[model samples]
Target chain A: MNKLMMPIRGDFVAPRFDLATEILIVQYNNGTLLGEPKTIIMDRASDEGLCQMIVEEHITSLVCNGIEELHYNFLLWKKVNVLDGIIGNWQTALEKILDGTLQQGAVLYPDEREASSYESK
Target chain B: MFTPDIKSLLEGIPCPAMILDHIFRIIDMNRLMEAMCGHVTDEVRGIHSELVLRSNVGNSRDRLFKSVMETGEPVSTEGDILNCYRRKIPVHYHISPLSNSENVRSGLLVVAEVLHVEEIKKEQSNKSFSSAGIIGYSPKMQQVFNKIPLISQTDASALITGETGTGKDKIAEIIHNHSPRARFPFIKINCGALPADLLESELFGHTKGAFTGATRNKAGMFKLADRGTLFLTEIGDMPLQLQVKLLSVLDDKRFYPIGGEQIISVDVRIIAATHRSLREQVKKKMFREDLFYRLNVLYIHLPPLRERDVDIRYLLDHFLNKFMTGLGRNIAGFTSEAMETLLGYKYPGNVRELSNIIEYAVNMCKKKKVGLEHLPGYIFEPVADSPVAAGDDEINHINHQTSQPQERPPSLVVLPEKTPESWSDIERQMIIDTLKKHNSSRKLAASDLEWTRMKLWRKMKKYGLLP
Candidate 1:
């Protein structure tokens, strides 16, 4: 089972990791959901606290937008795969990530024409 | 939910900052920088900083990015930028490497601190005019100072010869800043660092499809520094073939860009500097004699710091005060033994070495005075016949100059010297003192420090400051 956490702003991923306040934790296996996603709202964004939560919760992978090099290195050092600079809806990103089609720096905006254009590329 | 695009993010920033790609093309800039340009950030995206910035850019040949990549260290430099209104803003910018976990060259984050024109004038109001932060009191230094304004009045191709770390680069900048072409770009490039082909591209730029990586038409340093100064450092080490190309540019104020049809004419003042003796290099057939003669129209040689009497003590005190202010420490004058070690040491590295030593001492010193223990290990290690052994007269002179008998500056009120503990014991004491003064109110303590409640909470948690 692959356990992933996405720091979401709303329908889309937060534009930045240090500024994110809400996160969703979900478990899946082979492109199918293993459990209902759990949402945790933070009082304020803290890279330190978030790193601790990722470690304590045993998150196998992380999906977020922009991340500083230090935090990214720390997560990688802890063996957690990080997908950063993703500009897309959380649901669409989840589907793509599950099917192993999501790129690390993907920009999958909600606009169908734009998203389809990226797909064509 | 407001998802911020680049435009929105840039608009929100109050200070001047820009996102630049690896090639030094600005990808996006904040509203503050945009306002200075009198154009929107989107309009100027992908433009070179030399074109966008209206100020004299001293090192215009993609220096910050290249240096950061070479050393993985951030670079900071001072220059004058002209905005759209033609108002000159003297800016000190730190170019930090912005990269993801994978690649180190994602982009560059340039954060600029603009200095007030009045402040610049006030800084120069001292009887001895100091330019580009290079100050001197000795006769030789004063002579160089006198020559600066005279050189600035004319468009002469000058050569500055000096030992490494003797502030030759600073002198070049001072000359350009005081020159008639001060309004235009003052670009510099080190011929010794990059390979000849890369240096050629940087100096003469390249047209699109000129080489494998040339994606767009790029303007060279000569073009960027048109009607301004171009500082060529370490000219002796410049490749022989490249020297001929450079000599051609010197003979005629025109250069052909790599893979370009047209010749670009430029009117640039060349101020070349080198630590090596060109005369010996010419005898050895290493440097071009004609190019050397061309660059040597006017000569200024910087004396090594060891030879400059009393300058050692003066520079030590100056750098001590500077580093102390930045670190918010009250490190007093050096102890007699420490003074002896510093004075007796033959500074092969010159002024730059002394500055580094003082900075190191300041950081290591947690006492009322910098002691011998705070100095670097090189002082203790026996070198080839180190200068005169510790003398009492020199100690007295340094102490007299460093520690003044007067109403001392209030901001640096000396506390009992204590070693910096993890998280710092002084900070814990301050937190406790502020909490007590505010009657145990965390909010008041947080506000007093200008820190958010969360930040204070974390600190309190770390130190167990609250019950």
Candidate 2:
């Protein structure tokens, strides 16, 4: 069984990996879902605590939004598959990820056009 | 929670601005900020505000936007906006609450203006602090460096707060060094270091016969630091009664001698620092609220070393170079695995802890490159359930010792009945044999046994290996 974790905020991928106060853990066995998804709400934002959770739970893969290069490289060194820079609704991101349709910097929100559009000052 | 197209509205602001959530996550940043920081808006959104604004004054509990978000008010402060090229553009920023159409709070909107305040940023005084060897290029530290120039020109009572090893004293010295009063004496006293009477006498001069030891009139830190700066450290540890006197001194620039009727006056710039939160101290009545307000004119917060994750590698190399030559060791560098361990370790003691670890490694390393064997094992034991393995030798030994049928039924393998004493004797013999095998090198023996140096030393002492 491959365990996957994703740091989350409200309904989207947490903007910053270290400051994520909520997370989701999903277990899969050979592309089959193992059980119900679990959400762990941390009492506070702690990068070290999050990393500890990943190791303790034996999570093999992670999906996050913005992570500093130091942590990104550290997780990679630990052999965790990191799909980084992904934005939008975290549930959709997870759905796309389980099917191997997730891109490195995909914006998966329903209103992707508005989220991407910006007016310069 | 923001309104529809809040990012577009934020980008329409005339100057550099950003929208941050309650946790200070970058909800969005405008084009000017993107241009200044050289981070793509799409890629940068959701990062911590510190990564983008690089505000030197913000900590976990003490940020301008945080205060605004909490109190539902706006705050305007002077800060240095750090750019991608390591350039600091002195800026004045205003952080206000971003509310939804229903008047419900959502996030914060921060607007900044580039300041032409070149006079304050001038290379003012040449005098250096007695302790001025602060070195870090982390965005937070760079913000701190930028703040010194801005705050030094003023005589505001700057409150420096952080964990114990965050160099609060050094920052106070930096402020004094860059200030106009750099030529005068910079007196510092830790309120918690001395008894109440002595602390009072130290802050305010005492007359002859004031106490049993008062044989002559003694000048206090306020008197000694005349026309200079007086750094009051651990102000939170100061007694409540003394807090009133300290507040009066800050209020009038004068204080009465401990035993004399005469009120002694002095010209001094105040710079106080504490590791504890003055606000919390006030709520608990351990620190006076009025006194905290007096000292909180300009606040500077130092983030813990672990939060400055990018700087860990740089600091490791910097400290290694610093301690290696001094320790008379030619340790080249840390191996990648060792560096990874250091990077992953959340240094609770902050920068000072890291320096000690580096120095210890430098002193212990026998090879050109410092490996896992040179580093302590306990640094990696805090977060994991797996015991820290020094190397493959330790792993092999642990595997050997643990593969003795304990996991299976007792009938699986024939074993002799042994008392605890006999087991200790066997363990002792094993340690001695391992030591002999490694040429009496305790470090290697400890590695082979999968124990910390201290733990191995205790076992060695129990076995009478040390005279």
Best by lDDT: 1
Look at candidate 2 and give me any clashing residue pairs: A15-B46
Candidate 1 chain B — worst ten consecutive residues by lDDT sum?
B396-405
What docking class should model 1 receive? incorrect
lDDT of 2 at A92: 89
Using TM-score as the measure, the top candidate is 1
Task: Give stretches of model 2 more than 4 Å off.
Answer: A1-121, B1-131, B383-467
Compute the DockQ of candidate 1: 0.08
lDDT (Cα, 0-100) at B244 in candidate 2:
86
Across B157-211, the per-residue lDDT of candidate 1 in tens digits comes to 9988766677888989878876767756777788887889988998998998999
lDDT of 1 by residue, A13-113 (tens): 76456657889899989988888999999998787778778876889999986665556756764668888756557888898888988877675654442
lDDT of each residue in B1-467, candidate 2, tens digit only? 64478777877787778777666667778887776566677776655555355444444224555678778888787756444433345677777887766665656545454432433443442222212667666777777777887788898888887656678888988788677676466778878777788788878978989889787677787987887899988787998889888888889988788998898889998888776657667777888878888888887877666557877888898889888778777877989999889999866556777776787788779998989888765575644221222222422322232222233344322111222223355688898899999999876897899975445656875564642
Number of the top DockQ candidate: 1
- The TM-score values for the models, in the order shown, are 0.50, 0.44
